[model samples]
Target chain A: MAKKSEPQKASPKSLDVSELMRDNDQPNFLNQMQEDFKKMMIDKQVLQKCIETFLDEIIDQLTLGIIFDLHRKFKTKAYCLEVKENEEEADAEQSEELPLSPVKSSPQKCVCPNCAQQVAALRFARHLAKCMGLSNNSRSSRNASRRAATNKEKGASSSSSYSANSDDDNDEDWNPRMNRKKDKSFSPKKKGTPKRSSEPDLAEAINTDTGETDEAKNLRHTRSNSSSPDSLSGSGNITPKKRDKFKKMGKGKERSSASTSLKFD
Target chain B: MSGKPENANGRVSMHLDVNNGLERVTELIETRLIESGWKDRVKLACREAITENNQNVPSVDHLIEVITPKARALVPDAVKRELLHEIEMIFSNIEKGGYTTTLDG
Candidate 1:
C-alpha cells in the first residue's frame, strides 16, 4: 500500500513542493484579489458618477447656449425686444426706491388752498404757518409793524413837498387794508400819465398782506421822490444813485443798462 | 434647382442630416471630447462662467453668449482635427455609397 501511494503521489519531496505551490495560490489570496477587484469597481463607478455630474453641468450650459441662439435668431422682433428688455431688467442691479421726501424746484408755485393764490413753493410752508397762526405769528407781526414804522419815519423825514405826495401815492399803492375808495383814487391820479404809477399794485398788496418787504419797490419810490431834473431829463441814463446801488448789489453792467431802459420805458 | 445655386455649405449640411449622420457625428464628437479631456475642461469653463456672473445662475441666453465662444476656443486642436477628419470620411462614404445620386436627384 505504501509503494502504491508513493507511485501515485510522485516522490514525497515532489509532493511537498507541489503542496507548497498550492498553498501559495490559496483561497485567502484569491479572496483578497477578488475583494481588491470589487473595491476597484466601486471606486471606478463613483468616479464615473462624479464625472457624469460634471458632464451634466456642462451639457446644461450648452443647452442654455442652444436655446439662446435659437431664440435670438428665430424669435419674432417684438418677442426679441421683450426678451431684451427682460435681460436688461435682470442685468440692472436691484435698486430699492428710497423712502425719501419729494424735492421741489425753488421757483415752482404751489397754490394755497386757503387763499386760493399761487405762492412760491419754497415759501408755501411759511405761508401756511402764517395762515394757521402758528408759534411764529407774534414775531412775524412784530417784524411787519417795525418795517411799517421805519417806512413812515423815512417818509416823514423827507423835507421836499414832492416827498409827501410820493409818500401818499406809495401808501395808497402798498396798503393792503385800504378799501376800493383808495383803489379808485389811484386810477384818476395815473390818468393821462405816461409813467407806470400803478405798477405791480397786486404784488404790493400780496407783499403787505404776507408781511413781506419788497426793497425794490421801496427803492423805486425813493428814487421817484429824489430824482434830480438832470437825471430825469435824459431818457435812458442811469442816475448816480442807481449806479451805486447796482454796484453795491454786485450786479453786472447789463443789469444797470436794463434798469435804465426800464426807467425810460 | 430651387432657382438659387446650392452653396457648398448648404450641400454639406444636407448630407449631414441624411441617414442619422448628424447623430453619429455628434456621438463621435462626444467621444473625442471625452477621450481628449475636453469635457473636463468645458466643465471647468462652465464653473468659471457661473462664478464670473456673480455666482448667480446666469440666464440661458447670457450663458450661451458667454460660454459658446470660449468652449469653441477651448476645444483641443487634435480633437478638432480628428472631428474634421471624421466628418470628411463620412462625406466621402456617403458619396461612394450610391447615395450621392439620390441626393443630387
Candidate 2:
C-alpha cells in the first residue's frame, strides 16, 4: 500500500541487514555460551552440595562432641567421655573386683554423662591425656611428691601396707645411705638399677620387636619380663659384659631391678 | 564471577566461583565441539593439571597453612610444609588483583 514504501521486504536470499539470524559469530558465541552455562550449572550444583554437607558436618560435630564405642574393640576405633570426679569416687567402692581386672570383661552399664561413651580400663590413661590434657610433666611432678611422702613413711614404719603388697618391686628411692651396702648391691646380680621413670617399658618392648628377627625378639621379650628386681639391682653393678646387654635394653629398669632386689633381699 | 577470558588462546581460564569468594580455580573447557570425533586436547590438559595438583598438594598440606590461609586452617599441623611457598605465591598475586594470566607469555 504506501507505494512500495521502504522497498518491499527483501527476499530471503537478497536480504542485507544480517537476515536477522545469519550473523557470523552468533552461533559460535551461542554454542560456547551454552557449553559454559552447562559447566557453570554443574559446578554450582557441586558447590551447593558441598556447602550443605559442610554445614551438616559442623552441626553433627558440635552437638555430638562425644560418641559411643558400639563395638567393644579398642585397636580399631574408640571414643572416651569426661564425667564428674564425684562419680568416679562413688563408683570406686562399688568396683569391688579391683584395678587389675574387673568383674565384667567389658565396662559397667554407666555412660559418661557429658558425652555418652563406654569407658575402657586400658585406654583410660590415653583418654585422660586427650580429654583432660593431663600431661606427663604433671605426672612426673606428682611422682616427685609421692617419693617424698614415701621417704617420710619409710622412717616411721618398718613394713607399711604399700610395701607389703609390692615386696618384689625394687625400692625406687635409692636413699644414698643404701649405696654403702656394696655386697647388697644386687642380691639378684645387682643389675643396672636405674630409678623410677614412669615412661612405660611397653613402648620399648614394642619397638625392640619391630627391629629384630622373630627369634631375637622372643629372646629379648622373655628377658625383659624375667629380669626380676634382684637381677636388675645386681645388673646395675655388673661387669662390662652384662652392662653391654643392659645398654641394649634400658638403664632405669635394669638399675632399679638390681639395687632394690639386693637391698630388699 | 565474570572471568574476562584470561587464557583464551590456551583454552583455559582462571575462573572465580561467584558463590565462593574469588577462589581461582583453573578451568579448562573446550570452545570448539571436536568436529564429530577428535582428540580432546582440553580434557587431556585438565587431567594432567589435576594429576600434577594431586602429586604436589598432599605433601605440602602443612606448608599450605602458613602460605595458603584457607588451606592452612583446614589441614593439620603434623602435615608436611612443602607445597606452601608455590601456592602462596600464586594466591598472593590473585589477592592483589593486578595479575590475571597464570603465565607471563
Top candidate by DockQ: 1
Per-residue lDDT over A147-247 for candidate 2, one digit per residue giving the tens place of the 0 to 100 score: 45555655456555755523422344332223335425656433323332322354355435544445554455557756543233333334768745654
Q: List the residue pairs that clash in candidate 1.
A: none
lDDT of every model, 2 decimals = 0.47, 0.35
Residue-level lDDT of model 1, residues A146-177, one tens digit each, is 34654565567764676575566446433323
Model 2 — TM-score against the truth?
A: 0.13
Tell me, what's the RMSD of every candidate? 25.3, 29.8
